[model samples]
Target: MTQATAADAATFAVAVPALGPDVRCHVLQPGRPPLFIEPAGERLLDRAQFRQWSRTVRPALDALILEHGGIVLRGFPTAGTEDFADFIEQFPAFDGGYAGGRAPRETISGRVMEATRLSASVRLAVHSEMAYRRDYPRRIAFFSRKTAEVGGETLITDVRHLAERMDPELAGRLATLGSRTAINFGPRRDADDASYAHMDERGWNQSFHTEDPAEVNRLCAERGLEPVWHEDGSLTVLNALEPFVVHPQTGRKLYRSILHMLPQVENPEQDLERRKRQKYPTGATLGNGERLTDAERAHIDQLCDQTTYSWPWRDGDVMVLDNLQVWHGRNPYQGTRDVQVALLD
Candidate 1:
């Protein structure tokens, strides 16, 4: 047999993935919201085989993810936390760390982190990852270490389409006003300190990785976050960014801001204070500093629900999301669930 030229390696396929089934790929139901990629084959890939396959399909997979927002790769050879992070390393520009994120996360390895620790009964609302920060990741990946026996779907929705589907009047108002998020972080405190029950959910020392208030201020300023220190040894951070942003990859307008992970209520008209009281006055407001009416926020929440899509997590499943185009959330579940996240810049 004659040896193929080096050029054959650079551009392996001419017709853009004319050759497939290096493992089988499956999409979700035709009308379903989230794209599912199930690689079906008799045997799983060894490390070398997975690396080779990654280089071969990086182009096609990149295009597909940018176009679809999020895609799930199911039934792969991923066996555990370290193995999942290794698979993600094949892709380029993976920062391999979750930096500047508000929600608490435990670093499981160099590139992998334990997913949110929120109780199964609690719900994490749909929002873009670190949209409040000036420096935010462009990509996020999730791995299901274990699936809950009962209902727990990782909610995902297209932010661009969500923006389009929103009521024009509300959308226009948001675009004109933009949005601001005020996050208050307490001073350095033990994670299980009894005093924290009355303090912020996350402490400033943890968020900024420093016990020195001056260092926190410096870090916040560098990231376009304005910090105000209170007499009670707590810091309130305010970040205001455009509500609409152009996706770097697709050049399409995407819904870029939202009040994240707030507790939902039956009636917002009376519950605004309830949340304010419950969350220590951490809520989103207009760029000019006017509050978004509870009604308006409720409407936005409804639009998100209209577009929400998810499926039951299966062990060894991996999901990659284009952060600019997709917003993700957690669904309330009954049994135990283990989902891990890795963010890429």
Candidate 2:
């Protein structure tokens, strides 16, 4: 269906206003259209009030989500972990995967950005965390521990909406390009004073290729994707001809890509080699020969930027976003900006 017609089955209502600018604690009506609540206050609700509200509104909210995709709740006070956990548990949509503040573990990306001394000066580009993995998160939770000095806005774009806007031919072409992305942890320091090493023996990359090879080949051919294998045992697999994904619940299509690699990171050539080595130590190859042109790369970048929607952060702001429908990112800023994130299956 189309964007204008997609949310015809959902309903929403403003449940209460706690505090903050354009923030509203909303309770979505069951089986109704999608709702967006922007409250105008900066105060947070006390724990007892929060618990009461959750009990009063959860069923309708849960039913609404089962029919629609998701909802956004804003204008909550920024407090320590216990308060947030209490609030999250009251809603079924929370998925019980807490991130941020004191209880900042169990993240889907497996990376934690602590808030105590966190800075908001870094800009995060549009991307779905762990998108390269075969089993990625379905939902993401972000609790803002602090606001930014300037331009540290959170951006999110609905990929499903973008797909609805694209031409059918383009959509079909993208769908055929179902992809296999390889990522490397690459000896990064962990919170426990240890490093996570890239493993090749376990076939972290190659072994994750669970899609049908023949189908992948067929789509690769159609998309001019050139799958290549390098001498250093690195494999370049391309599947740029897949049609966009259609969400089972929302019936919205999403464009997919292997652009998860942070292009701005150092050592492009070396990084590519490392990725290949980690994924295909014994050497690997792709069936298609499609190489992205400068124009195509620019186009993709523009698309990513334009499709993003950012939520200006406030300490204690919790955002529940559909990982499949929205691509989220952050703008660079100054000062400590800590956030805890969680992913739901």
Candidate 3:
């Protein structure tokens, strides 16, 4: 899709009078994703004013995210985690919480987390947050505390666009067969240990935030995951997920798979050797027990890239997204890049 017209992007401003005459809104690039909103001048809103503004625009903000997939609030006076948490508190928290989340992140405060602890060299794949889970957040917000010197743009893509671009045959197969995702959690290895071979690796105890196996199993059951125990105290959870879904509010069909986030096979034929050689701790297979070929994956990646949009992070820049409609990822970067995130239902 082409970039939306200025009038299309200004709908939020028309609806939310509290945006003030000094604030400006526009699209980022070839597309209108993450509609950019910032102060038109040097005048910045204080914490109190920012909170009040957020409260007044909450209804419009929801509509904007649903329409644009994401939005970035730049030039806001956000100093630290407190300011970020305060801004997020204005929105309803996801009551289900992030108990079974797979990201290797640290919780900085209430409903706030350090985005990820992965190496800066690792480029994250674009996928909806927690799409594999039975109970996933409907919305997610991100905050950038420090911008990377070289790269590290938070990538986003509209799922509707991606679904539209997908091959009809593959899309139909996915819709009919769905997909099965599995995550393996071995005993926690030292972060610096060379044996740390898997992405986002964590012990089952750490993953479920509990010491008891029964508690972990209970959590898995509640989250629609089937847990399997290994002899070495490792745990593997399996879940079957629909690759396509209808948006609850919009009634639009969305491509909701996380195939890009997992290890993929290069060969079209699924064999025992390929399965054994899979290196990632997490992987997915077609619901019919077939693996997706790397060629097919490349096509999907291209579709995502064709619609993907990103912007360099600035200090205190906040991005809010409709998780069901948008897919998010990261680009490999150099230097220190600090980003925080919050999830909401």
Candidate number with greatest TM-score: 3
CA deviation > 4 Å runs, candidate 3? 1-18, 41-44, 188-197, 264-281
> Per-residue alpha-carbon lDDT of model 1 for 1-345, expressed as tens digits?
122246433212212242266554334433333455544464345656665666678677777677667667766677698878887786654442333356666677877876776556556678888777767778888899988888767888766676787779988988888888876666566663321222245677766666788877777777787888877677778888888888886777777776533533324455465345433356577877777777777877887787777766789888888888888887877777888988875
Lowest-sum lDDT 10-residue window in model 1: 10-19
Better of 2 and 3 by lDDT: 3
- Higher-ranked by TM-score: 1 or 2: 1
Per-residue alpha-carbon lDDT of model 2 for 256-314, expressed as tens digits?
45432243222346546765645432111111423344555565666666655554456
Steric clashes per prediction: 0, 44, 0
Sort every candidate by TM-score, greatest first.
3, 1, 2
Instruction: Provide the TM-score for each candidate, comma-separated.
Output: 0.84, 0.60, 0.87
Error of 3 at 30 (Å): 6.5
Clashes of 1: 0
Better of 1 and 2 by lDDT: 1
In candidate 1, stretches whose alpha carbon ends up further than 4 angstroms from where it belongs are 1-19, 31-33, 93-100, 192-199, 259-280
